[model samples]
Target: MIWRVATLSFLLTLSYLCFQPVKMEDGKEESMELGTQSQSQMDTSDSQNKGSNEVEEKNPSVEKSGEMKPDKTESDSGSKPTNNEKSANKTPEENMVEEKKSEKTVELKFPTTLEGFGYKFDEDGKLGDIETGEPFVFKVRSHDDSYNQKRYEALGEVITEYVYELLEKEANLKRVHIPVDASEGEAQSFIFMTEDALTNPDKLLLLIHGSGVVRAGQWARRLIINDNLKSGTQLPFIKRAVDSGYGVIVFNTNENRIRQGDKFIPVRESSTAVDHGLYVWEEFVSKSAARNIAIVAHSYGGVVTVELAIEKEAEFKERVFAIALTDSVHSLSHQEVSSSVIKLFKRIAKNWVSSKEPLDTPVPSRHRYECPQVSAGTNKHEETSWSSFESIFEMLDKAYKEVTEIDKEEL
Candidate 1:
């Protein structure tokens, strides 16, 4: 019975030992699977960290490249710019600068400001005060006949007397008269200075006379006709101009004998009255010390005035702010005048052919028609004429009023 019990105990112990070993083996296998899973998770975490670090390092480079790119855009396929994208991308300042540059390149070249008249470069490529060089020397030429000579001399005397009276009567003007000789059968050019006239450098009056009329006599005589010289005359125009301060100078283109002819006569091309007038203007009036001047031309005087204005367009553009034409012959368009009357005059005046006929005359058309083709090259005067002198004065008042209005606006 003791032997049987010991064997049974040994058997049970052996079985227990075997069961324990199997349980230990199962635990080892579970632990091994858990360790492998942890190792795989750690490897995956490290790979993700490295990828994030690389993206952070490259971010600034991508941003800099985007800023440095030219004005362009990529399409859905990343090949070309899309229209909608282009519209949204550009800045307003860039667009404005481009538009301004285009306008400046295409704009017409014309005078736009006051400074442009004085300082702007001309087609000749010369600057201000460079072309004239020095003051011009005036020379007198005679075309006077015996009858016209006496008439001119008497006219001069009448004018000189009237001016002397004006100097005495008008307290504003300090007048000095310097007489030149007309004994050579030529019309005389008188130089007069007024202290009051010279006081205003900004404003100047250039009084130019028409054909068959001497400037020296006609200028003052017209004042008499207008009653500006008489005590009863209001003289408001003169007073206002003087009060405003202006320099006044008169030029006599018709003082020459060629201009005083009783009838139209064709003459040598060079000896034409127009040629002489142009010569006188270029040499005398254009180079005068009075830099700023406004022309007031009467009758055929418009011819001479227009010629000078056109010839010196670049020089006198600003200075010659206005041209007042009174009873001017060249103011009317040739088309406006009767062609029959023109034909009749041509036939009648044809008999008086001489060596001194003006190039502008004896033609089928009026003086204005010939003006464009003359040595003057272009016409610059604004035409103002009426059927009568009364109408002319009315227009003059209107013109003066308009000028005053413009001055006010500028101020």
Candidate 2:
């Protein structure tokens, strides 16, 4: 009877342990009814979120244990959702903006270094063709002024170097660095010249570009960006000069900053446009052995030439035979040029000013003491040099013939 009683007690205890409500995995002793209520609340939350554009709706699924969990909707094959499926609710404008952002992120990424831009100087300090095949667009965000300015500055420096290389390769010109100031210690400005420029050529063509960011061989960077390189660079003029048997000298007037290590220092002596012009005229143009020198000055370059004439009147009168200007900003009164120099300049020089009139048509002079003004065939400031290119060569030819005829008569 005792054994029978013990067995019955053991059986009852085992049944109680096995059948008692098991604690949820969540450590809460919630009933099945409570779990069902929680799932119902999650479904209601999801439905409410779907109505608000600001709220993101989440997929809810009930686990085997009857607990609600956030779930991702997948295909029967268990594949992830496509980008199209994920962005299905986006508006057309939003989709277009997103696509543009994606494209900019991927395609518009640019390198921050010179070599990364596919330009490298060789052992001889000469750059070869760009290997990366990247177009130099100079495109920057308009909202960021300071950042874009710095970027444009860096790009301008690299473009100057590339143009220097082009002058050597395409135009068959040699680079000559003349010291502008001995006090500044190695402060010098370079110029491009033909091989026979200093070897006593009969006629010399001095090509002087405008002020600002333009260097020795560039007419306008804007044209390089918007138009073709042939219209933007001085190679066409150099080629024409060579074909006409004239030695070319391309002056580097705007290189007022020299690179030292990784930083740029101001070339104080040649810093100002007039100072650079004076120094180059004294050190380079006067030193050349060419007999008849003609100047093709553009914009501030015309001002430089005027200053040159004022400073070196004797040498100017003796050698400089003709001056062809394109949109010159020369001011005889502002520059304090002498009356005698002004009269001589007026006789020898002609300006191709930007105007809407026909090419080479006479335009009324804008300044009191100025050269004869003629239309450049274009109304744009930067387009003047290129548009007046053919007319300029013709003027040079006529001047050379007239000057040589006078010289022969004197002989």
Candidate 3:
């Protein structure tokens, strides 16, 4: 009778343990709807729950400290936990926030140098295409001219340094700094020349650029920013001058300011455009022992050449065999060119003015008696130098040969 009672109690305890309710971590009991939920439905529900947990771990808020937040149930929003909360607790608002954070993290990095800027150049050095790093600030027109000028100057500074490096390395030019002012010994202007420039070769070619932010080895910074390096810079000109057995000197006429200690100050002797030209000519050009000289002047450089001629008339006429001016801004009355200088200009100089006509085609006269005008092929002012490059070289070569022949005959 005792054995039968013990067996019956043990069986009742086993049945109670098997049929007990499933208690969750939250202390709430969950009952499975076995009849309504199939095997596929149960599997799908588990997968959705696992996906929510993975998203919470992997997709942390980038805007925040990039840390994962603790899991929150429907109870956090002042609502009772539902059966569906087990699959996914994220609201529509939470999903949208995560999407926005991911979008905000994506950014494009702009390049610092021209080589890394992803621009393509053609054989003639024209800009074929741009893949990246085009600053949009330049495209938008501003009402303020001064503001635009400042921006362009800043951009030109970077390009100027790059061109200076190219001049030293690629063109094999030496940079020489000359003190312009006795008071400010540290503040000086610089020029680039061949090794034989000071030694005075048989033939010398002097390149002078326009006014503005253009430096020694640059024709136009605008073209460099918008076009290609070849069209904008003076590397091609320097190379041609070297290959033709002529010593080259490129003037940094526009670089009038030098950084002294803590502040930027104007070079004493080269404070103005004309003054700079005068100082360089007296210090370098006049001092050189070159037999025959040639000048290639562009824009305000034409003004400088005229000033040099006026100041040193006898020397200019005797030494300078050729003068090629591209869109020269020289004024006979404004710059006070003398009758003697006018005669010299007519004898050896030719102005390649920007025009729609073909290259070397005669254009209308500008003054009573300045150098004769010919079409530069391009109507653009900035492109005049590069467009007339070939014609100018041909004129220089012909003049050089003729002058040398005349000297030989005299001897």
> What's the TM-score of each model vs. the native?
0.34, 0.66, 0.67
TM-score of 1: 0.34
Q: What is the lDDT of residue 242 in candidate 2?
A: 91
Q: After superposition, how far is residue 295 of candidate 2 from its true place, in Å?
A: 0.3
Model 3: CA > 4 A from native: 1-137, 140-153, 180-185
In candidate 1, what are the lDDT values of residues 189-237, reduced to their tens digit?
3333345344554666655544432333243232232122331111233
- Candidate 2's residue-wise lDDT over 152-245, tens digit each? 4565566667778889997899987766345546656677899988665598888888765678898876554335567667888999999998
Residues 141-253, candidate 3: write the lDDT tens digits.
12222323343344446567878998999899999886634653667778899998867568889999876557888877656655667877889899999899888899887
Better of 1 and 2 by lDDT: 2
Error of 1 at 219 (Å): 5.2
Per-structure clash totals for the candidates: 8, 0, 0
Which residue pairs collide, candidate 3? none
Q: Given candidate 1, what's the lDDT at residue 257? A: 32
lDDT of 3: 0.67
